[model samples]
Target: MIEYQTSSFSQDEIRQAAQIQIQELPQGFLSSLGEKPLALIFEHVATSQFGVMVIAKESSNNRVIGYVFGATDTGQLYKDFLIRRTFQAIRYFLPKLLSWDRITKAIETLFYPARKQQKRQDQEECKAELLDLAVVQDYHGKGIAQHLFGEFVEQLREKGVGCFDIPTTAGLDRAHRFYEKMGAIKVGSVIVHEDRPTYIYRYIIQTRKHG
Candidate 1:
């Protein structure tokens, strides 16, 4: 059996989640920052008021097997991370800035929300977003991801979010399929990092109206 709940941001649990993130998303930019820095990012998110991190654990062992984390306002999340984790962010990201390619990508990431707003002016802008979701390889096909996603969605709902967006690498067919299966509509695509295409999907939360 597996249990899922919002994370308390414990050091050990953050370490486990970071390990899973690096293992499952080796090519992601955050994973390139090394495990310790990645763990710091997880801790930051788990503690942020605008963010939510849900973890899945084995019932008997209480070992983290999966996690899904995102923010109620992605723009604010990034801004807050930069402001609150300034020293650590500089310590870790400063080294990566030495590479021209990485610098360009970082700039693009920093301005992504503004660019997205310009590109999708006709559509409703969704401030809320589902940033990352990952499950241990051994736990795949066990419905852990679904449970984690459900919990994250519930968190957003409780926060009164009407809709949210999910951006994933273009080639991740399994993830795309899962989002589609969960009723997320494909919105469009964008290039956030040079040479990498990302697909965007939006999900609307159906809230019942009280009579």
Candidate 2:
């Protein structure tokens, strides 16, 4: 009953669906939301998947079950955010990478976790990222997440983008295992959240024609 659709950005449905599991999502996840009049990072999604963001719906109930948001063209956004938050980054990243294990264990104690984060120089090769993904608790175990992910990945593949990201919380071992089993690589964690038990993970999507 899940129906995938393009993100409107104006409809509260996407944000509402996300609120169902917002606390479970990562930080820096929605920093783009409040930045401008439009507020979200990706507004174009082909209006489908490649436009940057999308939402999944349940036809029978007419409810938005979940959503995944991302855009590859935001190098400037990340670069600017990092510069503006330089002090916080310096103060936090050191201990984060230093005590990754401990942080991973107590991530629920951490604030809204990040499903993605600042990237390294080498990772600039990666294009899109899974900023935040959430399915309503009542809709869990019904393959909703997979459906949403499939739509997003397929769209990115069509665009010729290869690599993407999926940030995870160590406390949510089940989630980490899910993405890994789905083919994502554990490149490492964000230095700021290493000690906090949260990590920024990555995945590669082959071209649509090839995949």
- lDDT against the true structure, per candidate, is 0.88, 0.57
Clashing pairs in 1: none
Q: What would the per-residue lDDT of candidate 2 be over residues 1-211, giving only the tens digit for each residue?
A: 6778754455466445545444444343233123221222233222333336667776786676777766563444455434554565456443443555544533422322233333455545464667656777777888888877788787677667888866566677877877887788888765444345557678878654533
TM-score of 1: 0.94
- Model 2, CA-based lDDT: 0.57
lDDT of 1 by residue, 54-116 (tens): 999877977999999999988898899988999998887788678887788778988887777
Best by lDDT: 1
